[model samples]
Target chain A: MREKSGSRVSLRAMALLLCALIGASPVVAQELTTSLVDIHQGSPLSDRARGLGNGGYELQSGNRVSFNQWYRASWVDMHVDLLTQITEDAGILWGFGTGEQGEKYRIEPSLKLGFLTQMHPSPNSTLSLSLTTTIGGKLTEKSCQADYGDLGTYSVNCRLAASQMAPEETLKYLVNAKPESQHLWLNYRVTF
Target chain B: MPARHLKFGIATAFAMLSAPIASAQEAPDADEMAALCHGGLSICVSATIPAARTQAATTPGWMSPDVGAAWAAGYKGKGATITIVDDFSSTSRFSGNFGIGVQTQRHGEWTREEASMIAPLATIRSKDFTTSSSVTLAPGLNVLNLSYGMYATAGYSPNQIGWSAEEASIISYATRGSAIVSKAAGNDSVAVGGVTNGQQDYLDLALVGKASAIFVGALSTNGTTTNKAQLAWYSNYAGSNPLVQSHFLVVGVDGSKTDLYGTSFAAPIISGYAAIIGSKFTKATPTQITNDLLNTARTDTLVNYNASVYGKGEASLSRALAPVAIR
Candidate 1:
């Protein structure tokens, strides 16, 4: 029975590793171009941004890599992009007492899937329009930690261990960090 | 001479019978006295009167003083309504008047007073569960404070607990996440739903998995932002169940400060906290507000913190209100 249980665990681990390798593999591209962009550009590679909504400002930043594929057929042209973003430092500014007492920061990884299409009336024409749609949200299976601190030091989820203590006993700060809101983005670009 | 003696004896027998009848009329029997008392008589001679239940008067100081910061930030539970459901009167009378002379203080009165003192600007409504079990939800953000519990003579399963109209209504609201429900973990010093002296609080069992339900326990003393607090000697702890632990919270009861103590007083503080959170996160849903409080609870502020004992730990209004935007 013990040997059987060990074999089952080994099989599960191997299966998970295989899935990770497949997901990490780069997309097969006939032609590929990759470049880093500003975090605020709203592209898949732009993994960080700040915005004001619902009465407060929120800063969301993450590390991400994107894979893209372009296909051209006789009738139409298509582009597919897959991006994975990992939140390393996402913070929100909230006033508690004097100074920066209530600011909160967290980390959680997410994946974004996007599709783009472009049409050209004639090969010689310089005018073209491309439309893109992207869907993204936080991954459900991620580990998090709760930190009760004044300085907002750690970047992890607020699901703390049962008996963990804060760095400073005097200031026992609690943070209400929620999962990133799921979103769908559409963009249209016209080139001349 | 014999005829005169017979007439005297007959007169004596008549007098004795009439005298006994008159005495019976003057002093009613035990059954007759009980009947009179049931018929609304003011006084029933030789009847046992149950002792008058008493609670300590409300103290002037607020139990959780750190709420001052939230008040300073202009989140004094404005635009929210806190509905207190408890035994406001022994006669099952519903009175909107919170004035001193209108009615004598009962268990419900202390809870109402504490919640009002915590969030003075918030609207407070009383729901006398004795009169009717059904409760109507208020228009805007609503926080319902249940300082009383429904118990049975013998232990019953949650299904067999036989929820009344009010329990059903409150449970419906909690399950649907329509309002924030703060319940007092009973003062029996047992885990929630544990039987105490042959009686069990079935209401706690019924509310175990509801979405917005929170079971509040009492701490021994007033809690400060800098110091850790301990659970009161008589307050119930979160038992070994993870579901119960997830929804439980502890706050300072401080009978010394409030002149009132028990899990009953502990619940209103959480209700006030919910209303205050509503004032800040004006657009947040009831579930969102509930989560904000639970997720932000501080384990560091609790001495010997154990999930099974303290649940989510101490409810910190400052931490809950610290978030500027809550989805």
Candidate 2:
């Protein structure tokens, strides 16, 4: 079975090579394109990575309380994150943020690539469209979730939910969402 | 739990064009073979983009649904349900324009349309999995499609947190007869992790685990003909992950025309195929389906393509579903 699979993979490699040999330009190497860099502030992972409930939920008095809008959870809050480019266009963009109580920090690192509609001679004044997709993981500090008034009165102890990576939960939070959890995004930016 | 299912079918017209020898083994009758081959040829050639285009049409290419229509596996996936998890705004104008297996844009939405066009008959669902989670894994959803990833920060290395709960949930899905497909983000991470790509810890960790997961990298879609295939300039390379050593796959996706670039889009193409396979063999475990797809991929479009970037080469739905001869 392993050998058959190996042969199958080899076959695919050969096909792609043939496509390149027959269809690609050989006179000269393809010109290098500029890599893209940007800053994004969003949660890439859902509650899967939170630790087993133990810590207290940090609530700020009179502060805006945000619901996931999709998951119907009262713990939704926004964080400010920064992603920087490491190479000419390609690089790593990551940020660290805490929950409302400022006791929890989530680690987010995104592998990002950017595409611009057009390149302008004026590096500073060019207006371009950027499309970037970042694939990485998120880790949360071991903190506890306290039942807040927003969640209504519940006797069940809500110690910090165990921190784990749940692909399904993460996806569900994004799909059934009203505003915050949507996954695909497109933004326009200026070089200045 | 890991029972390997073996299937063998004669090469379809599409397969024969690239592997003539394989076709000869199955179709001894030249006339029948010619008809099959002709049909495929027609589909492949006909799928080409017409010469006319507005300035809006950049990097034009299309897959001919007709070429392998007869010879290609007719499985549009009978029972499997695929869930694509992304962060598109729920109120975006892209929703009502949704259609399976055909390309049309109501607004900025493209993937949902593309997925439906690829497998119009499959039971498909889309959701947003991006939220504040202490745990990355959702409790009990099958075949979750998470095509997004984080960049890998100093506090959290790649191998340690990159797989976290999301990776665990994928395993959970596989154990229950469903699979997950993740797109390898397209940024070149040479600076962070040296040569291959970025987030060595994360990509490496995910690759080594024996879970029923797939990491699809990207390929350029701007060739004039089928031969001009090349890895996207920004596709990441796998550093050293034992699991990833043999479990990578690449598939073609035209992100240039839409905002859907990166392995983010590539993962769904694989998910669509998985949906078809799962629907067909309802009893098969996720591991079996995962192995079958890997075993059946057509690597022709990624010659010399980095194993880290292309992974087993471009995916082929027709070949993956090749039937086992009754005789």
Candidate 3:
């Protein structure tokens, strides 16, 4: 776990949520000229490697103990966006997103720059076309913690008395516990 | 005969039944499989880390209830001490190519490793018994692990000779002192009661007399399914007497990082558990700790779930350390 970096992300996300809730009043909303909505979504493009392995033994108290195990996880994600104007004939469309990958969800930060073209076939109907591409986003590799102190339950097997469950069973328990990708919506609609 | 004389008598008779003691078979050590990270753990030893968190992270069940989850929760057996009494040597003592099993440095080191891996902070001492007449408990030792046991020769039961005088002395000392003795149920399949299928083990009546002593049996998991593990085919489990049933316990001895196996490995697991439990309930007596472990064990982990084979069930660190509630 990236203690410093992860905490920073958590703080920023909390701050963003706090700001969203504060300015949500209708009176404050009407004063703003821009009516904008941003949406993002993603999942893995391929299967993730289980990435579990064990080294042999080390001396502890002058005795040999099992070497710890290792684990890694990677996933593909997808997100999208839609835009429209309230009072202007010319409209602007934009999309920006990120992917969650590697051990700590190394944020695949990407900024999308796009232009929208509007075609008015008649007074009653209008069609719009937009194209956007993201930049500076890539997946990072995640492996099990190399250090025992950092591994938590990852380093030990779960036991009921002397009889214990398998090593991966405990690992799966830990992996299953971690939060999956968040803040990405596959489909979206705005209500007025 | 007096208690001391009788204790010596048991030792003499045990020696008479044996000469060069029958060697524990050189079965391929299964513990190496544990190094493969068998029990569903996601972590393994890397080519990194300081001297070692001692692989305490990966050996969750054998060392800690949840793979050092107890340590993270801050209940490592810091103040407790475990005394291992066996015909084991403290040092390797050999050059290369010595394929030693239980008879030499390999066994003792493996047992010590298992206990230390679980309770790294606890003190572990090997009081060798190769030439000694009787085992002694160190002043502060809270747990004594006896991973060796007498053989059942000529198809005879354990009662033919009360018990080994050396072991009996240790058990007697444990009974009167603050220490608890962890004994290995022998390898013979001798049944505790009338079960014909038995391994030559500690199915003797002498073991029942010591309230402070516990007989440990080896266990093995059958598959990935939860609670699929069962008593190792060779582990002894005779429950003809009440104390045997009350004092008996089973722990897993699957392949460990170092290729060790048998009840030899099992005894130390309980020893480690005892130390860990003792660390949490510093005020609890050795009897209290022993009883709590027996009382709180998880029988569900047994495949057949029979008290005759599993004793009171597998020892559970979490249950023993959990707070005792009042109405």
Model 1 clash pairs?
B133-B166
lDDT of 3 by residue, B159-270 (tens): 4555446655765665674687887765555544233333233323445656667887777532122645777776777465666888888876654422344666677778
Clashes of each: 1, 99, 51
Cα deviation in Å at residue B64, candidate 1?
2.1
Model 1 chain A: weakest 10-residue lDDT segment is A90-99
Q: RMSD of model 1, in Å?
A: 27.9
Scored against the native two-chain complex, candidate 1 gets a DockQ of: 0.01
Off by over 4 Å in 1: A1-192, B1-60, B91-104, B224-226, B324-327
Off by over 4 Å in 2: A1-192, B1-61, B64-74, B90-109, B132-141, B154-168, B174-178, B189-204, B222-228, B240-242, B256-259, B305-309, B323-326
Candidate order, lDDT descending: 1, 3, 2
Predicted candidate 1 versus true structure: per-residue lDDT over B1-327, tens digit per residue: 122222223222211111000000000011233432322222222322111111212323434544544333334688889999866654322222222323335566667877886777789999876554588888899999987776665456778645667778888999999999998887778898888888667778888988999999888765543667888887888999888999998888765533455787788888988887677556677888887778767787778889988999888664554322211
Q: Kindly report the fnat of each predicted structure, to 2 decimals.
A: 0.00, 0.00, 0.00
Instruction: Report lDDT per candidate.
Output: 0.52, 0.37, 0.47
Task: Give the per-residue Cα lDDT of candidate 1 at A47.
Answer: 20
User: Candidate 1: which docking quality band?
Assistant: incorrect
